[model samples]
Each structure stands twice: as C-alpha cells, then as structure tokens.
Target: MRVGIIGFAGSGKTTIFNALAGIGGDVAPGKAGRINLREVQVPDARIDKLSLMYQPKKTIYASIQLADLPGQAPGSGGGFDANSIAKMREMDLLVIVARAFDNPYINAPIDPASEIGGMLAELLLADYTVVEKKVMRLRKEAAKGTERDLFEQLFATLEAEQWLSTLELSEQSLELLTGFRLLTLKPVLVVLNTPEDKADHDSASELIEPLSSFEAPIFALSAKLEAEIAELDPEEQLAFLAEIGIQGTARDRFIRAAYKSLDLISFFTVGEDEVRAWTVQRGANAQTSAGKIHTDLSKRFIRAEHMTCADLIELGSEAKVKEAGKFSLKGKEYITQDGDILHIRAS
Candidate 1:
C-alpha cells in the first residue's frame, strides 16, 4: 500500500519520511510538486525468528511504500497544486505530520491542532468541490435517481465538513463513488512532530486526546532526533533506541499505527528454501488469502495445513505441533488469523 507523508511547511515531514523509509530524502525548498517515493520493509521479530529457525536460503518480509510530498501550508491563496493533489489521490493512506515543536525557521506559531484541522478542511473542501460540480452537472442534465440522490447525500455530509467515510452507503453507492477517490475516505494517521526535550512517547497525550474526533490513529515523536538514527543497522538501531529510552524506532511505531488503522495482519510461509511474511486483511478467508501468495494457489486450493507461529516456537517443530494436535487442516472458508503459518495444498 502507498502512504503519503504530508504537512505544512517546516513541519519536518522530510525528516519523518527519511526515518520511516530509511532514506536520505531531501528536497530543496521552494520546489513545488516534488514527491519522493521509497519502499521499506515492515519490521517484525516474528519474521526474524522464523528465518532463524528455517535457516532459509532467503528471507522475505512484507514492505510498505511511502511517498513524501512537498509541504504546503494550508489557507495559502494557492491550495495544493494540481499535480500534488493528483499524487495524493493515488495514495491508499495519508500520514499528516503536525508541528508541535518550535522551529526557528518557521515564522508561524506552533499549533498542531490548527495545522491538522486546517489540512483536514482542505481535504474536505477538495472533495466537496468534486461532489458539488457533479451534482450541478446532473441537475443541468435533469438527472434524478440513485446517482443524484447519492451525491446529494454526499453533498450534505461534505457540506458539514465531515468525511465522506461517515456516510453509510450500499455496495452500489460505494462502487459509484469509487471513481472520485475522495481524500477523506482514505485511512489517516496523525504524527505530532515535537521538540526533542519533549520526545517522551507519552508527552504529547494532551495534544492528541482532543483530536479523538478525527477518529484516526495518533502518535508523537521527534523526527529530527530519530531521522539520523534510522540509517543505522538493525542491531545498532536497537542499541540506539535503548540508549534513547524509547520503546521502538519511529519507523516501527509508524508501521504499527498504519497496520492498526488498516486492520492488517501478517501470516507466514516457511521452508528451508524461503521464509516469507505476507500481509492481509484481518478477516480474509483461507482461499482469498491464498491469492496473496499466488493466484494458482487460490484457484486450485484444497486445504491449508495451518499452525500458529507460537505453536511452532513453543513445540520446537512442525512434527511436534502435529503430534500435539495443534496443526490442523483448514478449508477455503476458514478465516485467516494473525501469525498463522499456512502451507497451501493446491491441485
């Protein structure tokens, strides 16, 4: 999935993006419409343990794609550039960085609440524009029925400055609105960029608590402090986190936030040849999830020999798990669970 990093100028989004992607993402100021894209592996200790146990020729971890966009201050006469808006439309999720720290270069007062609120308004305005234009065009054409009615309902919601996602729509209405790609409909994660002195994970709770109305995942970290450390190797990174007294790296926290916001889970496939982690929706069925591994597996799916990663680790082997009756064969309709190690049996 592609996630966009966005915020107003001097919010340190590039630093956050670099931290998340493990890259030196730098763009010269005053460059309009620039977007930097990078894909980073989603860190999971489960994959590490499985890799160690299997001694695989190769280990594969699921990755998330990130895009960092040029910072644009909201309420500016010129809103998001057409190109920037287009780029945002292509993203599956949005990460809005709000400034809570003082930056000497940024002249404006630091108000994360106002910054995020204004940015959300921008998104609402953008969507409202699209719906309004559509509704007007339909009226001009003397259009009536579900199509007009749907957008009319959307108009009322957007008119109130609420996200389109708040409206409950049928499958048909959802399909109809799919083409618009409303910005507010995308899952959002809010990150507060705070001063180094206040970098403690819980320090920004007050700032975040009031934002509960956004109904998005929220967290705080000092991007400037974490950016450089993100370049370190895994062992060194862990050492640094311990030294800094933070529970985890900024990247791991951000990944967890995104995963929770999206209701995602990872399943594994292990062998001597390869050990890989695959991400899927929480409640995806066995055959549906088999398609994440391979289409052929889903097409010819028989039954999956499923065992929990915890079971394997506890019992010390697949044989032991089977001996304990912890390994069972599940049919196509079986709901996939987190950390399930699946061996798909296909024709």
Candidate 2:
C-alpha cells in the first residue's frame, strides 16, 4: 500500500515520515516537494513467534511502501504543484499530518484543526477541477456527435458533481465512477502532531469544535519527539518512550491503521528456502491473491490448502498440525482470512 504524508508548512510532515520510515530528511520549513519512498515491515506478533518456533534460514515479514510527500500549504498557494497532485493521485491512502505544536518564527503556524479543515477544502477543490475539466472534454465530444457509453455516463456524473458526496449511488453508479479515480473520494487519515509534553492529549476533545464535520479517525503523536526517539538504540528507545509514558510506537499504529483503512490483510507462504508474508485486500479470494505472489502462480492455479499460523504455533510442527486434521482444502472462491498460511497445489 502506498501512503502519502501531507500537511501545511512546518507541520512536521518529514519528521513523521522519518520516524515511520527511518529517514532523516532535513528539518527545514517551506521546503519544496521532495518525495521519499521506503518499505516498512508490517509488524505481526504471530510472525515473530512463528520465526522463533521454526528457526528458519530466513525470516521474512510483510511490508508496505510509504511516500513522504512535501508539506502542502494551500493557503499560501505553495502546496499544490501539478507534479505533487499527480504524486498524491498515485497513493492508495492519504496521511494528513496536522501541526499542533507551537514554533516561534515559523513561516506558517495555524490552529491544527483549522488548518486541516482548510486542507480538506483544498483537496475537494482539486478534485472538482479535475472533474470540471473532464466534463468539459466530454461536452466537446458530445457536441461533435461522439456516442461512447463511458463518456455519456461521465457526463451524467459531472451533472451531479455538486452532490457527489451525498449521492448514495447503487452498485452500478459506483462501478461506473470507479474508473474516474476522483481524489475527493479517497479515504483520509488525520494525524495530529502534538507537543512532546502532550503527545497523549485527547485530540478528539481538542478538535471537537473545529472538526465537527470531519468523519475521519484522528491519531495524535509527537512528530519531532518521535523522530528523535527513533534515532536511539532499541533499548534506549523503549526506555525513552516509557519515561514519556508512551505505550506503543506511533509508526506501528500508523502502518497498521493505514493497512485497515486501505482494506489490506496479510497471508504467508513458508518454506525452508524463504518464509515470506504477502498483502492483499481483506475480501480477496485464493485465486486473486495468488496473482499478488506471481502471475505464474495464478495461471497454474488449481486448489489451495490452508492452515492458520496460530494453529501451527500451537501444534508445534507442520507434521503435528496436519496430523491434528486442522488443514483444509479450499477452492478459488474461498476468501482468504488474515494470518492464513497457504500452500497452493497446481499442475
């Protein structure tokens, strides 16, 4: 999954990125767009336990790609460049990093809630612009007597653009609009960057007045503090977070939450050669998920036998697991559950 981090100027977007991805982007305000891509291992307690139990030659974990997009200050008109918008369009999820700390002399410092409200408006405007442009093109095509079904459908959607968000369209309407790729329709994750001293502040209460209309989940973190904490040794990091009364790392929570937001889940393929985790959407069945591993696996697909990692760990061995009659055979239509260890049999 590709997650793009964006916020207003001096919102500590890069700090959040570095904390999450272990990158030290310079701490400068008003910097232009600089895209940083990093693959983050998806933390799973079950995987760790299994690795310890098996002592395999190699231990592999599932991973997702994160993109640290530059800070976007739409109020200053410095945020949305053509390239930046295009980059955002390529993301599967958006992480809006909001500034909640006070920094004297910062070029842009506004109420985090207010800033986020304005940012959402800007995103909506950007989508509206795209929709308007497409509508105009379709109009020209219609005037020239073009009679494509897709264009006609697009024209109808463009007419209802004012109430697009409110229209609870049927499956058919949704399927028709799926190809448009409207940015406003994408899921949003709001990350509120708080002061180090107040990292655990109740953002829901703090943001109640300013963000009453926003329906997205809000996560609070100390971006600058987390970035500094991440640079320390693992032991020191744990000690530091404990001293600060932090129970878990924000990066892990962000990644896991982002995974859920994108409707993604993990499955595993284990062997002495390589035991690796793979990601696919939650509802994806066996055949569709096999395609994620390799086209060849999907092409030669027959049936899949499945067992849970938990069952294997409890049973002590694969031999014992099979002997216990826990293994089950599933057809292509079998929807994969998270933590399932799959072995596909194909001819």
Candidate 3:
C-alpha cells in the first residue's frame, strides 16, 4: 500500500517521514508540488522467527511505499496545488502531521486542533472543486449516464462538507466514481507532533479531544525524538525507549496504524529457500491470495496446505504440525487469516 505524509508548513512532515523510513540527515525543504517517495519494509517478528527456523536463503518482508509531499503553506487559501493533489489522490491512505510542539523559528502557538482543522478544510475544498467542475462539465454536455449520476451524488456530499467515504453507495456507483480520485474518500491517520520535552504530556490528549468528532485514527508522538531514536543501534534504541518509558518506536506505531487503517493483513509462505510475508486484504480468500503469489497458482484452482504460524511455532516444525493434525487442506473458498502459512497445490 502507498501512504502519503502531508501537513502544513513547519508541521514536521519530513521528520516523520525520515523516522518512519529510517533515513537521517538534513532533508532540504521540499518545493511546492514535489513528492519524495521511499519504500519501507513492514516489520514482522513472525517472519524473523520463520527465517531463523527455516534457515532460508532469502527472507523478505512486506513493504509499504510512502510519499512525502510538500506541506501546504499557511493561509495559501487556494487549496493544494494540482500536481500535489494528483499525487496524493493515488495514495491508499494519508498521514496528516499537525504541529503541537513549540519551535523557536515558528511564531504561532502550539495549537494542533487548529492546524488539523485548516488542513482538513483545504482537503474538503479541493474535493469540492473537483466534484463541482466535473458536475458542471457533465451538465454542459447534457450527459445522462451512471457517471453523471455518480458525480451528482459526490457533489451533494462535497457540498455538505462530508467525505464521500462516509457515504454508503452501491457497488455500481462506487465503480463509477473510481476515476475521480476524491481526496477525502481516502482513509486518514492524524499524527500530532508533540514536543520532545513533553512526549508523554496530557496536553496532547486535550488538543485532540475536540477532534474526536471527526472519528479518524489519531496518535501523538515526538517526531524529533523519534528521529533521534532512529539514529541509534537496536540495543541502544531499546534502552533509550526504556529510559523514556515509551513502549515502542514511532515507526512501529505508525506502520501498525497504517496497516490497520488499510484493513490489511499478512500471510506467509515458507520453505528452505525462502521465507516471506505477503500482504493481502483482511477478508481475501485462498484463491485471491494465491493470485498475490502467482497467477498460475490461482488459475489452476486446487487446494492450499495451510497452518497458522502459532501452530507451527508451538509444534516446532511443519512435520510436527502435520503430525499433530494442525495442518489442514483449505479450498479456494476458504478465507485466509493473518499469520497463515500457505502452500499452494496446483497443476
């Protein structure tokens, strides 16, 4: 999945990006309408254990593509540039960074709610403009079809300042609206960049309490602190986190939140040669999941030899798991679960 990091100027968007992507050093301020893309491996302890047990020659983890888009300048008023909006429209999710930290360079007070409110309003305005223009074009051409009706419905939602994602529409309507790439239709995760000295402060909660009405997933972290932690070795990092009484790094929390926001899960394929984690939607069935590995496996239409990772771990090996009757044969219609170890049987 692809996620975009977006926020207003001085909101610490790049700092979050660097922390999550494990990149360090100076990030030159991005120009308006530019996108910085990076690929990050999704951390999974299950894969690490499997690799150790199987002695695989190659081990691969599921990854996500992250785009760091330039921040919207405060009071730009006209909304985001067309290029930036187009890039963001292609993302599966958005991570909005709002500043709650005091910076010597910034004169504004640390008001996360207001920053987020302005950013969200701009997103709504951008969608409204797109929908309005589309509806007008359709009307000018006197168009009469599913596409026009779809735009009309979208326009209605945008007019009310409601996200299209919140509206329930038929599958046909949804398919018709796919080309529009409405910004507000995508899932959002709000990140409040708290001050480093007050990383565990209760002020973050107060700042976000009013935004509960939006009902989006919200988290608070000290991006500056996280960036510093990212520069440490693993052992040092753990010690530092313990010193601060933080359970985990911001990267882990952010990635987990991103996965949850997208409703994604991971399935595994294991062998002596390779142990890999594969990503799929939560409700994907055996056949659909096989396609994620290989189309031929799906086309041949056979069964899957599967067992949960927990079973394998407890039983010590695939042979032991099979001996215990923990390994079962699943047909194409069987729904795949997270942490399932699957072996496709095909022609």
| Candidate with the greatest lDDT versus the true structure | 3
The per-candidate count of clashes, in order, stands at 0, 0, 0
TM for candidate 3 is 0.94
Q: Against the true structure, what is every candidate's RMSD?
A: 1.9, 3.2, 1.8
* Per-residue lDDT over 124-148 for candidate 3, one digit per residue giving the tens place of the 0 to 100 score: 8889998899899999999998888
Selected candidate, larger lDDT, 1 vs 3: 3
Higher lDDT: candidate 1 or 2? 1
Cα error, residue 56 of model 1, in Å, equals: 0.7
**TM-score of each model, paired residue for residue:** 0.94, 0.88, 0.94
Candidate 1 structure quality by residue, lDDT tens digits, 30-95: 543567789889988888999989999999998888898877864464567767777888888898
Clashes of 3: 0
lDDT of 2 by residue, 139-229 (tens): 7766543224444544455455432444455676567667666666677888888887767645335643465567776778888877887
**Scored by CA lDDT, what does every candidate get?**
0.85, 0.76, 0.86
What order do candidates take by TM-score, descending?
Answer: 3, 1, 2
- Sliding window of 10 residues with minimal summed lDDT for model 3: 24-33
